[model samples]
Target: MWGRRPARGTIVKICGLRTIDALEASIEAGADLAGFVFFEKSPRHLTLDAARALVARAAGRIGMVALTVDADDERLAAIIAAIQPDFLQFHGHEAPERVREAKARFKLPVIKAIGVGGREDLVAAKAYAEADMILYDAKPSPGAARPGGMGRAFDWGLLNEAPREKPWLLSGGLSPETVAEAVRITGAPGVDVSSGVESAPGQKDPSRIAAFLHAARGAAGGEAR
Candidate 1:
């Protein structure tokens, strides 16, 4: 997976995909990455068998990401054997040491999702030195059903001066209407969307997916494919 270096454009990841239509739409839209949620509470959560089937369809066409929330090694091992994702996204409260350990044990790249609200959160994300990439998403509301995919957004200005120590993605509350502005404001090299392109929670719309990719690419100064 590391061998397929990102192309010369802003990386776009459409997360929480669950169907052949959504998977095919992502690939057809030239998305750099496709994400699958594995957290049980998430509406977009997928069974190992289902994820494996989607991964088989996506073979070599796009990067597959397995997203989890504080999963233990047994769970992680099971996911690795089944989905064979190119990257593991730790969207929970896994410490830097845990992130490092997972990379060592699994022999795969890791993407650590940091809940961002202010400058301090950005500073703390640097601790994940071993993470191949970092994803900055909005912090969930109190007692929210899930940590992410809530469709809330933080101030894009918060990342205007963020240090470029690691590759990062801007997420949260982005839609086809706003992704261009987000990319312009944050100057993020990558952007990720889940609920933004969905017709509803857990339901992806191909037209919206295409529109988002178009906007994101234009904002990144690349012509839309």
Candidate 2:
């Protein structure tokens, strides 16, 4: 099982990476996790073959996260077989039972994403007792095309009084300019970013990745130069 916090610094995840350059930038920038989207609707979506190539290149270099949206057994198996991801992020409307089932069936740690717009959303997280980690992302607007990675953020203050058990990451609306405040406000053990570091939709920016990592590290009292 994953712990509630990293042993040293605040964990940073760079999500929606689709190219070797983005992957390399995350590695060089000292990001703790590298995420790839599998949802076809997402602009950052990667095909199985593309995922395989990137996974091969990232082998043993950083932690890999396979982000999916309410995937069935076959889709999960195919992705797992191809990328062998270290973590599976359920970024859809999957119930706690599904999360528990997927974790057990796949023998991989699960990061359950909760869309938080208010305190009511935080209450829903309590039901996911079996999740290895929790990601608090901004809730998508009505009729949004995608679930996450939209660069929208909710009120960080909403988490001020929320209690935590397992490891959790603060996502949505995070960027190089705002990560420090997000970290300071939430005291989150980890942070995840996608559109925040992109030059355009689905295009990861190396410089932005580096800057975000530096800011997050500085906020966490780690080596940030």
Candidate 3:
């Protein structure tokens, strides 16, 4: 929740969480935020009723994030009414103008997710300064069905070459085994995981969830570059 923040270190967000066991696993493990996917195209997508229930279950224990991609105002209105999320994550090809409009309309912190396929994408991320935060995830390959949640990773070295002043979240191809290295390399203040912690697409394994959170916190405070 707003008051229950993660400790002073890297922010760890477990995204695409669907069930109560997985949700509790993240909170008990001291995650800063838990994200729910709203896109139907994703295997991890949740129905409006399901998202509402999960958000209610969080009960301010962890920051509740509603993730969407290229959604219009009418759809967002219904989602906000149902979930009332703490943050809105735009994981689509939303332009800077769209991000600004969403922030103004929702009056909530908006996290703009950029598809990082190359060094040039970092430059793209900087354009949305009006966004409350930025999320750097691997670009979905051409002809891919979705924008993200493919569990593919981009070149982490690109972030080192092009840095931004605003806080951002690092995602893509992160699991318990490689998350420490990712944090060590990028100095990302936050990290988001979806498929990496799953037993299968849309199925969350509590054990993997616990392990990822443990590994992330252990690596959070280290120096980067």
lDDT of each: 0.89, 0.91, 0.84
lDDT of 3 at 169: 85
Q: 1-225 in candidate 1: lDDT tens per residue?
A: 322225556789999999999999999998989999999999999999999889989989999999999999999999999989899999998999999999999999999988887788888787888888888999877677778638888988998766577788889989899999998898888899999999988999999999999999888877557
Q: What's the TM-score of each model vs. the native?
A: 0.95, 0.97, 0.93
Report the lDDT tens digits of candidate 2 across residue range 1-225. 446445556799999999999999999988889999999999999999999999988989999999999999999999999999999999999999999899889999999999998899999999999889999999998888889637988999998756587889999999999999999999988999999999999999999999999999888887543
Model 3 whole-model lDDT (C-alpha atoms): 0.84
Q: Which tens-of-lDDT digit does each residue in 53-123 have in candidate 3?
A: 88888967988889999999998889889988889999888899998998888898898888888877788
Error of 1 at 26 (Å): 0.5
lDDT for 104 (candidate 1) = 95
Error of 2 at 157 (Å): 0.9
TM-score-superior candidate, 2 or 3: 2
What is the descending TM-score order? Answer: 2, 1, 3
Q: What stretches of model 3 exceed 4 Å from their correct place? A: 1-7, 222-225
> What is the Cα-based TM-score of model 3?
0.93
Clashes of each: 0, 0, 1
Report lDDT (Cα) of residue 178, candidate 3: 89
